[model samples]
Target: MPVTDYQGSTSSPFSFGRSLLSLRRDTTAIMPSGEEADLEAFQRHVASTLAELLPAADAGAGDEFLSAAWIRRLLEAFVLCQEEFRVVVAQARRRAGAQLPVAAERMVAEFHERAVKALDVCNAARDGVDQVRRWERLADIAASALGAPGEVHEGQLRRARKALTDLSTLLVDDAAAASGAGGVASFLSSHRNRSFGRARASPSRTAVAGAAASASASHFRSLSWSVSRTWSAARQLQAIGAGLAAPRAHEAGLAAPVYSMGCVLHLTAWALVAAVPCPDRGNALQAHHLPAAPPRAAFPWAPPLLALQERLAEEGKRKDRRHSCGLLKEIHSLEKSTQKLAEAIDAAPIPLFGDRENDVREAAAELAAVCESMRDGLEPLERLVREVFHRIVRSRVDGLDSSMHNAD
Candidate 1:
């Protein structure tokens, strides 16, 4: 089905109803007129939107808009929202018992299970990316130390290097091809106006319906901004990966090192795919009843993680030739940082609307802030990792060249 351009008049390949707002408002009269009604309406809108946005065939086929990371995220979020709504509906039906039809009960259960399965699939794909990233980093370390004077056994290093290189190459080729032909620029242009409401800190629920309506509209817009920023990082990684995969001068025995870098890029691409979520199909009841965000806790984990990272870094700085140690320290720091960020995410609340009366919005804003901070921290780590790998590769190549000239 053609998607309606949020900005331009250009028709999408598949047709969905005019705009999300119009479709949602049109059905408001036919549906019950409260929080539950809004949620049902939102869920229907999301399902219909997904039906339109998602490819009619295989997800891997690479339809221009459907293939985008943001689109995937939007779909995932919609599925989650629907799942949550179904749970509520089931619970309410159980309370009403004899009043609700058996068929209605069965249908609700089925929808909930389907949503769960979809979420699991999305999560598994995300985990695959994370696993590949860890391996890629390991490969970088091994490749960088190829010709360096180290106590590590040559045989073990060579074996590890070969394994990492091969795996990296395979993963990169697959991801690059699977990503399809659509560029980020084209995707952004097509869906520019699909923003959702800005979540804010609020303390009441009396006006939640009005707030939810506005929030439903703005949430995607905010998400689009977040996704676009993340895409920039993904693009950088892809470019680097492409360079690593390219043939270079004196490259005969150095495929492992180059492929190691490529692995990082491929892993990054997969991570981007994992991070995408669908549109926000939230309602007042779900927003009010959902679990509260994590409580503000002491920084127990941060201190220890930071201490270890600092200790490793100090040890590396004290020695002149501990480049490997320095790299290890950097890796440790990144790991610690990642852990801290994850904890923050687990504890942070997600806001559902921008209204001051809605506490959900406040929680959501806090979560967004933490995420922004995490992104800031990751930028430096990414740069450090890239520089370390480049330095190691360059030094190794220089060493190999010098040896050849001496032999001549």
Candidate 2:
């Protein structure tokens, strides 16, 4: 189905009678009326912001689709949706006399469970970013070796060859794993069920492990042991979506927003796994990886969300993308450029001269350009991933605190 423009949809949150917002309005009649408006505004803002992530119909999958910048925008949208959901829920609880209805509270708790799972996905994505950075460093070394003007010497050729070889090894290992092997899964798993109301220091161990993970490209071996051999991004995504369902007709008021936020969270995490390296992403990339598709007609945000999902899934099915380490556009460019450079280096005569020399130079320059794009893009992407991590942790803690306070 063609993606419907959220701004033009008759069922958008702007009009109340024909959609889920209407039911939400009915449910909130027992509370202060302003709470319903806040909830509606929350859904409207989510739809509009997410719609911005959709590419134009005629657009190609260039830097704007699943590129680093695009994924950052996706995360930014999720952050907004999360913050708004928190406010709307808190307001609903207040208007209902310091407590949500039993059904709404259940939905809130379920959303928090998904939020906790997302934290682990965030950490895994950070490692993937680090993995890409390591590749960048190696590529830079290769590019620098061949960048000098005039006749290229054997020393330069040898240095470039070694760098490319190392890069090839890293790429092969990464793809063989079918997702990068490193993550902070064990560290986060320990605190998985901890109540958010309790205060604690940030886990220094994670910082130390991340530092180690970011070490020189040669230390790629350490990544294999950082996370469990059995950890799979696909399973983690499945866990998040397990038991997730739309709110029943009687579960009104806050239920709709809770369901909306849950969908946002699941999509955000799934997309990260799609774009970044994570364990067993081959399985994660499958058609059945997502929870059964949510009804597109039932929610205003569904069109844009489904559109993005369909596009990413199409990218996954492409023959060129099948064996790739990650689906991020830069990764595709990285692999292609690196391969051309590697092939050029491999096919060069031992002494290197004439057209062959120019070929090597041309390939190195192309790889260098790809490396530069990654260098500029990966840091901001990493920062956004880190921000996502902190927000999920904060939201989970706040939700837990609110739940405890209400019980008291």
Candidate 3:
């Protein structure tokens, strides 16, 4: 059976595969140990290669999307190479961060530069720049990544590049209209799907994995440590990569290019780490912000963590709203407010932050002093929020009081 000939029927096995891909069942998951090792190595190679390309971007555009999005995609074969790089780097940071001294902390700046170049070229090409001045700089970066093994994003870039070439050669009226994402989506969708039937579970199981890991550290310190370290880097890379991957302005919100909360948290945490007066002193470590995660402690005072276990029992109760006359719009009104803030982030150029970062630095510094002086005033507030949110979640999911066993 020449698999391609299943052209028109719902009963086609090909169609069935398409359906599976959409469900996203851990198809790529749980691969054999050997395969996992190979995959990890392949990813590492990509991360390092991408790093080479950053210098070029840093040289050209410090804080901008480079050119526009459309033009570069048009020129680069529509490969959207940078997006893959983003994903790859994010993963690399987590795995490699533990190993690298300062690289993990500083990689974001490099990513900002690389994204600017790739995105610039993509936008320029899409907007009808018939023959762009040969960007010798981009070519240099692209050249280095051409045959590199660590070039994980290379595959992504190649596909996008092919699309760009095809669009230019064919003079496609609407490159997007012709984008065969649906077919590919269907194919992948059919081959692997997990959400076909609702996973009778909350995503928080995965979302709160960090919290849970921190909570049960004694029994699973090794597993928790590995997951936490890996996720921190992977998640950051994912954010930056995904932000620039999408066509500019298409879904700017999703591909948010500017400094995000994640970036803030990351830098803040690191600054706090560097600000640590002395590691040997238990008192200062206790006074630090976000509390250095509890991997080593038998019982860590991790807020998000404590919140999760507390959720085993607590349930949040929504407050009553009597001003039902559209007054409730205020809660969601923040949507627009969020957009402006996001735009402010994107519009601002790289070294995307200067004073705000300093502000955060100052804030982190004061946290220890403030915590020492403030003591338990807000601690009860913190505990209350933790207990309530958890109770609400547990009761909603389990339909019974999680704290029933612990009742007085």
- Would you estimate the TM-scores of all the predictions? 0.25, 0.80, 0.17
lDDT of 2 by residue, 310-400 (tens): 8889988887787778889898888878767766776687578889988999999998998998988898888778777766766777788
The residue-level lDDT of candidate 2 at 198 comes to 22
Q: Report the lDDT of model 3 for residue 289.
A: 22
Candidate 3 residue runs with Cα over 4 Å from true position: 1-83, 93-101, 129-408
- Which residues of candidate 2, in runs, are more than 4 Å off? 1-33, 57-63, 179-218, 224-226
Local accuracy of candidate 1 as per-residue lDDT tens digits, 50-143: 3444324454422322122323333333323323343334334444552334444333333223222222223323333333344334333333
Cα-based RMSD of candidate 2: 13.6
The candidate that achieves the highest lDDT relative to the unseen native structure = 2
**Alpha-carbon deviation at 222 in model 2, angstroms:** 1.8
Q: Relative to the unseen true structure, what is the C-alpha lDDT of residue 357 in candidate 2, on a scale of 0 to 100? A: 82
Model 3 lDDT-worst window of ten: 323-332
Which pairs of residues collide in model 2?
none
Please report, as a residue range, the 10-residue window in candidate 1 with the lowest summed lDDT: 277-286
- In angstroms, how far off is 308's CA in candidate 2? 0.9
Say which prediction, candidate 2 or candidate 3, comes out ahead on TM-score.
2
